[model samples]
Target chain A: MCKKPLIDLHDDKLFITFEGELTLYTIANIEKALAYVKTYSFNALQLDFQDVTFLDTAGALFIYNLEKYFTKKEIAVTLLLEDTTQKDTLNLIKENMKSSHKSVPRKQKSFLEQTGELFYNYYIGLLSFLHFFGKLFTTNLRYITSLKNIRFKEIAFEINESAIRALGIIALTSFLIGLVVAYQSAYQLKIYGANIFIVDMLGISIFRELAPLITAIVIAGRSGSAYAAQIGAMKITQELDAMKTMGFEPFAFLVLPRIIALVITMPILIFVADMMAMLGGLIVANIDLNITMELFMDRFSEVIAAKHFYVGIVKGPFFAFLIAAIGIYRGLKVKDDTQSIGFNTTKSVVESIFAVIVCDAVFSIAFTNLGI
Target chain B: MEFIKVRDVRTVLGDKIVHDGLNLTINEGEIYGLLGPSGCGKTTLLREMVLLQEFTSGSIELLGKRLETISERDAQSLRHQWGVLFQFGALFSSLTLKENVALPLIEYTELSEKMIDEIVRFKINLVGLKTEDANLYPSEISGGMRKKAGLARALAMDPKLLFLDEPTSGLDPISAREFDSLILKLRDMLGLTIVMVSHDLQSIYDTLDKVAIIDNKKIIYEGTLQEVTNVKNDFIESFFGKMK
Candidate 1:
């Protein structure tokens, strides 16, 4: 609001009236209004607060200072506040004028300084992440060593929610992945009359890489974000605080169950993904490349070894650990705001997906070097 | 001057009609309170007054301008004339109290950094909060302090009119009384025309100059606080408990 308080100079009396609400918000406008006051020199000043609509402590202080300034000049100052409802607040402000804290100005940081601050925040985030993992590992080891506080029911529920409930989407995506790989690879193999080799391609690709990759990606989107949001919501509502006050370890009670569920589910999901993807490839190979199911099975058994399937399922629990860990970690990162829940959920899903891909690439390099 | 004038205002919420032929005028330098049962749309009527929602039919002229026909520029300009304090304070959770109060100043004016800082401090102090609390986030503060911060944010623009929703519902008796007096002081000093929706009997009895009680899809009672409480109604009796 650029509305400066209007000062109307009348015959033998200076009537300074304020228009609109007089509060800290109007302080800038009030300053401009004061400048309007400073320009005039009247021996007798009558400050009429009759026209002011709303007055608070700031408005009171302004009027008080204005009066003080005039009284200092030996000018007659008449404060007519009889018309305003803020007379009491004005009185209170007048009483407290001596004690009002003079606000100190904080220095503004340069762009480079702000950027350095961000790096510090990032460093803190990394250290906290390491601390969280360390706590989780020790708690998990303690639980393993002592079976007394094991929450079997919660782990079962977690498995049901994050794994059993995720079966449909996982099966669908894995099947599609297999279908896509077989169809694309058959196009190249078919041009050279090597359509029979589609079985080897589908079997090895689906079992070794495609199944585990698609399964991990699906879980990352579904269960990973869910864990983050669930834990974040709990954190926001102070349930985590209540648990800590009651001498309950959040890691043992909350985190371990989800971890156990994810670890158990991941290997099983990979196996399911392997079956579905191979099934999808079989369907695609039979339809697109004119290869019989019998011939496909024969080449599959001969060309693809059992160790290929083991290679895929073996990485499942590790990927699951990465997904669940990041999800819960991001969940714990959620602060007091509602928006942070959504933000942490997104971050968890993204980080889990990235971790999965990075782990897959590492496996690729290692497996290639080892000739597996 | 009539700060807000509503005529033939009909607001339909889904299948139910909330305001049927609603006509009211809020004058300048007055404290108007809205009273109703739990689901009687007291807050909704306040929203209607603020143009947070428009009536299904009829006209509302705020600050001598019809809200329905107002342009975007006019609406944004008109926003400076009034400010609303939502029930939950609705302070930006991420911003500290001072930053929240300074938001409107930064957005609406070209006031210098120093002026903005001083103004923010003043506003926070005006709400009876210490200037030191300005640096604390809303979550770090107590509920009373949060409400005060919200009040500071609402007063950031220093509009001619102010709207409040349940200003004292969560406050204890003393805090509520203090808040009521703060309202009185604001109204007296600034001469602000304010409309508030409140369920607190003490707030209703002590603070407001005028009352509008909505029931049966309309404002059944409208008068000075003395006149409305004098009415013989079962709902009013139960809600206010035969106002002392």
Candidate 2:
């Protein structure tokens, strides 16, 4: 069929003369003709069905769709059915509309019914997870392709400000944490005349858990919150939309850079946190036990194996992913309301921290079993 | 000739049908206004036409290609043909007006910095903003100036099709009128096909070649301004009445 033509009505009313059978075969012809006539301004569509030799349910369904389309636009469609074949089709449409109008008032449910409905919805939601998963999988390639344009400078700024900016505070906290762990362990060791092994205790704790967990927590609050707030505010004000409207994918332009930045920088920060905690432990070992800095270092290297270092570093990127995922998810989920930006930012940080803790525990436990 | 054709688009956000089989045909180089009250889904429909929205069912064709079926790379490249000015004058707060206007050229093309700067300056001048105004960020500029800056950015791409959402909103009467004149001048100079979502009747009448009014989740009126002006319906009359 030819592309639809613009139909202009010259008067308040016009005649639509249909000169063919209203059968299944002729439905396509009728629709083609109607498409051309529907493009322009019109008041009413007059259907001339006198020449129609036959009409079936398919033809009836086509007309029903047309009537619904026109009616919603406030344009009336009048059926001029003169043939017996057309009469049955028109009658069927009228009856369908009447029955739909009478369908039990779309009954409001009782509490029990509502509960049942909620359960049913939840079941359907479980089934619909595949749909969500499929969309994400299909869109993953596009997301990856956007990585090409991510300026390294943009990523560096995001990472440096987000993860590195909190370094001083993290170091301070790690120092206190190290001192406390060392002192507590020394007290317990003193009870058994094994106070000298405090070096092993502080070193193991810092490398294995304290440093990684503390650094992850710091990032979840600082970098993750910033990412969410920035993106969320951009979304609320339509800067993200502006990018899309200008032919730049918002995911590529705004999101990918931050993801790259966090991924690159998180491990580096964890390394810093580990060093600070070790230094704090060294201080405790020297002052409390009268051990030299050199001696403490020698024992720390001996007790904390390469596995601990690898484990901590591995968790950094995973934690980064958790932060980026939560941050971007919360940002993308923000509503148009300006207040939601701050709210979502807070939500992202909390969710990131929670997710990090859970994932870290799972990873540590699984690795402990594997003895990695 | 119809440059953009929407064929029976039916869109729903979950349960609510925002566009119930909405259809529109916009011709080239004409200013078409999608006029409606808030919540009538004019923006949703425009977004659908531009392929920014996914419809539950129906088809959209722009410049002879089926919108839904087009390759994303093609979509991105073809999108250069249209420029959208979002409702809030969505400028990057981090960037100055010149940088904002130059963004598209920088993103879409391999233009050198100097050439991009000259184009950005030309666009800023076209929107009636001074050269000095180009250095100011969106937060530093007046709301009216921001809107003009948005228009300048939209024009920077030199798009054949331009989409605008509430261009006259939040502007003083003079600024609104000035915007209307600038739109007319742009259309005259570039022969741009403009589609805008607006509730402002005065702006609609001043710049539109045709106005499509959305009501009850459908297009209630589509015609010349004079035809809409002559409409006697209470809502239609009151809309024009307020402008008068």
Candidate 3:
């Protein structure tokens, strides 16, 4: 039940009467009515608002923009206001419109500029990670000297979360890997009447490389991302700041417990994974190579050296340290946004898994060079 | 002119009965305040009004459409008719203030980018935020600025009805008063029917034209502050007693 503005053109002058609420909802209809006025030749435009019931910011802005449009065409304009309140609104909107004209839109970056920014961000990230690592190292050293400074309860909770809960998935994945490796080797060994060689292949690969690598990768995805997300969320909600205010170093309180728990549980988890893998290989050998379980165990103990087990288990702590450190480092790097938590969690997983594989490669080269 | 009418709304959140037989009417062009004690489901009622929460029974007629049975298309169109400002300024953390304000316009309308930019600048200025603040993310700004940015985004579509949840809670006295005045000015200029949930007494007294005090799972009083002050209720007595 709103009346459209009446437009009448007489000689060189134009008269317009506005009625009802001249707000955002009605402004569109007013625009359609005025669309015909642009075709007429008028030197002076008179906007009569004596009967207008209401005028909002958008309405005021529309009138202001209409005046500007006519004035740019060298046509003069006059506004007849019925109320002081409407006049005040129009003036308020007019003032804001003038100030808003100064705001520049964000500029687009060129390809080179974007590339340069990417490189610069990576450099800064590297430096920050190094600083975080140094702080973590020194905090661990200082806290390790004092037994009471460590939070044993929190460490236990973390172990339950990262290690104990992860057993089922790790067991399944390691068993499957062991079965596939033994089956593949047995196929080729049986061709040469060397089906017993499957034991040597399964033992060396599953114990020295596959078990440790798979376990680290799984833990990296599971516990590493959890660490980053937990710490990052805490940072976002300012809980880290709260801890700092209460004289608790976040490194000692949040990061150390996670790192210690992961380190202690990692070797133990890897050892279980190694045993499960050997059992899987034993089954495969018994099934495909006609070797009995007792016979396979006898050959396995004779051939599989203790050094292979040591090499795989030794890398467990290093992989754990890398995953936990990267996770915490990424978590601390989270800025004041929820999206940063997601981004950092993803980065934590990717970086930790990458670091684990690279460290494994280095270990392989070193052990090979030393004739281990 | 009746923008919203809640009739016998019964809300049960889990086993806890949040509201029973709640009824209120919000007329057009009035700053209506929903005042209550803590844990009285004031925010819950606001959420229910905005369609973020559901009621067990009865009807909430917003803009003449019953909320419980409103179709998806009707709900979508009705949503475009009102703007909601959450308590914590619920701004997108990733986007800058300008982009945050422009999101609704970009998603709903076919306006040109240049036009959207102009409208964004106007809204940012209208809310008393500096032009330079447009480039900064929500996390970079203070609580007051974030609320202002949120208000700006809420107003971007130039909606007829506005809903504000505790708009002055986290602000300093000066900023809070400024916010109250801004609310008054926006209502006057835009002809907006505002439904605000507020615990701030000063804000309620300064800005509200009418108020509905909810206590004990139902509205204890619904009228002007002067009339509400005369009501014989423990909550009303303690709430307004602080005015002394």
Candidate 4:
């Protein structure tokens, strides 16, 4: 099934029907659905798997995590399994939880220690998606409110000084990126006797990957470092503490604004980078493959699907979110002195770039499998 | 009324004991000095008062309420009642002096721009900075000026209690004395209860109504400067001995 039938119940009963291949990709959606279900006022959840056609380790783990979560909430989970494989998977999860629960000595651990361990594990397990979502929403709220209060002139100055200074470098990087993608794709296209198709290849590649990735990297270096150093230095100096002492949440005032500014500006920058890189590819394609601009445009239209645009746009905010988060996180984590300011700034840029790449990879895999 | 009370406060960082069974009280409008040499846990005690540093044991009561028992929001609310001048005047370099001073006022109040600007200018001028200096960034200012600017930012909220750590450490002798005067003036003018950590003997004598001396991980002396000076102990004597 392309979409799972959502179960709505007044009581604690959760009924879910999944159809299609149950891989890690599909399993994540199911897990999200379960989490959404949990947020409702419910005491018991009964999951129905009557329409689910496939089962895998990924799907099993998804169910297991949900089960563990529900067990902690003291909510009973009843698995309605029609298939033997599904039953076996449920049994495996139940047995695993039982064994692990038994392993921890209840008497040896203090209540706080056990609670701390539980919370830490819960946090780590939900970190990738849940944490990002929380950060994104809360950070957006924080930034919006901070932006409203601050002098608009200061924000303009920051944007002009910090973001505008890096615009040229971003353009240069995106231009070179387009040229590289065109140059690389041209060789393979030439071997296939479709040398003119290099335009199509570069257009799609840049729109779908290189432009967004390059722009994100540029931002990671430029804006991310700026954000880190600004806040990191604030933290180093005790301005962050001063803000708190004055009854202002640092995350709301400091991190929130930068995160908001980055998220708002990054996608626009990516769009700009996309257009410029596409032009770069056009120039290279005309010189290397002798394709006219008109022909190149026609070929790009024919070959570049809407899915490419969807994928590119989808990753923009994700990259923006990641860079802003890593920058702010490293900044806030800074302890003592000017040395940590410099160190965390470097770490923010490096980690932001690495996170952008990894996120791009995951999105690629997810989109490719989803046929988006 | 005593604005802040610390009872049997102890702090351990890993295997190291930072503070052991320390107790103190600061009345309203008193400039209480925590005088100690380096590594005597003065800063640690200061951090505990702000709730930035957790204590291993004991209770910190600010405004007659226990700190650890308060909710996070309440703790934050209580913390907001004080302005802190960290050792370095940790002004947000990204913000101009005006903006740095305006931070607390902006965060806690819904005052109009004219109002905020007025308050910012008032605090800046209170610390003896020119209004032209308000447009300059913290880095653009001198070290002593930065410290004054930090104090201005702290005072922007019109705090009831003020915490200052080494407000005079790196300043010239003149600037240090001036800062001490500012502290005395603030305490007098605003009736601010001040908690400060300093090794500067001149500042101690200039501002503090009472002093708490930390030696060997615990408070060895808790009294006025004259009381601490009269103590025949070598460390206390020698600590004040350099003044003459």
Number of clashes recorded per candidate:
11, 0, 0, 2
Cα-based TM-score, every candidate: 0.51, 0.78, 0.56, 0.73
lDDT of 1 by residue, A308-369 (tens): 99899989999999999999999999988999999999999999999999999999889879
> Model 1, stretches more than 4 Å misplaced?
A1-47, A51-80, A84-86, A92-98, A105-107, A110-117, A146-150, A182-198, A235-248, A332-340, B1-244
Off by over 4 Å in 4: A1-165, B229-234, B241-244
Model 4 docking grade: acceptable
Which has the greatest DockQ?
2
* CA lDDT, candidate 4, residue A241: 71
Candidate 2 local lDDT, residue B190: 94
TM-score of structure candidate 4: 0.73
Task: Please give the TM-score for the first chain of candidate 1.
Answer: 0.75
Every candidate's DockQ is 0.01, 0.50, 0.01, 0.42
lDDT of each: 0.83, 0.80, 0.89, 0.80
Over B1-244, each residue of candidate 3 has an lDDT whose tens digit, in order, gives: 8889999999998699989999999999999999989999998898888776789999999999999998856776877778888777767675799988897787678999999999999999999999999999988999999999989988988999898999999999999999999999999999999999998889999999999999999999998888887888999999998785
List model 2 lDDT by residue over A1-372, tens digit each.
222222436586546665545656667766877765566677877655565556678777776777788789898778777767567767887688767764456777899999998999979855654553354445556665675654666777777777678888888888888888877777777789875688777766777788888988888888788888888888888888888767777665666677777878888888888888877777877887778878777776787788888788888888887888678767877888988988889898888899899998999899999988
Candidate 3's residue-wise lDDT over A208-309, tens digit each?
Answer: 999999999999999999999988887775455423322346788789999999999998889989988888888888999999987888888899999999
Rank candidates, DockQ, best first.
2, 4, 3, 1
Tens digits of per-residue lDDT, candidate 4, A130-230, equal 66557657646545565465535545655665566768888888888888778777777878889877866776788788888988988888888878887
Better of 1 and 4 by DockQ: 4
Worst 10 residues of 2 chain B by lDDT: B226-235
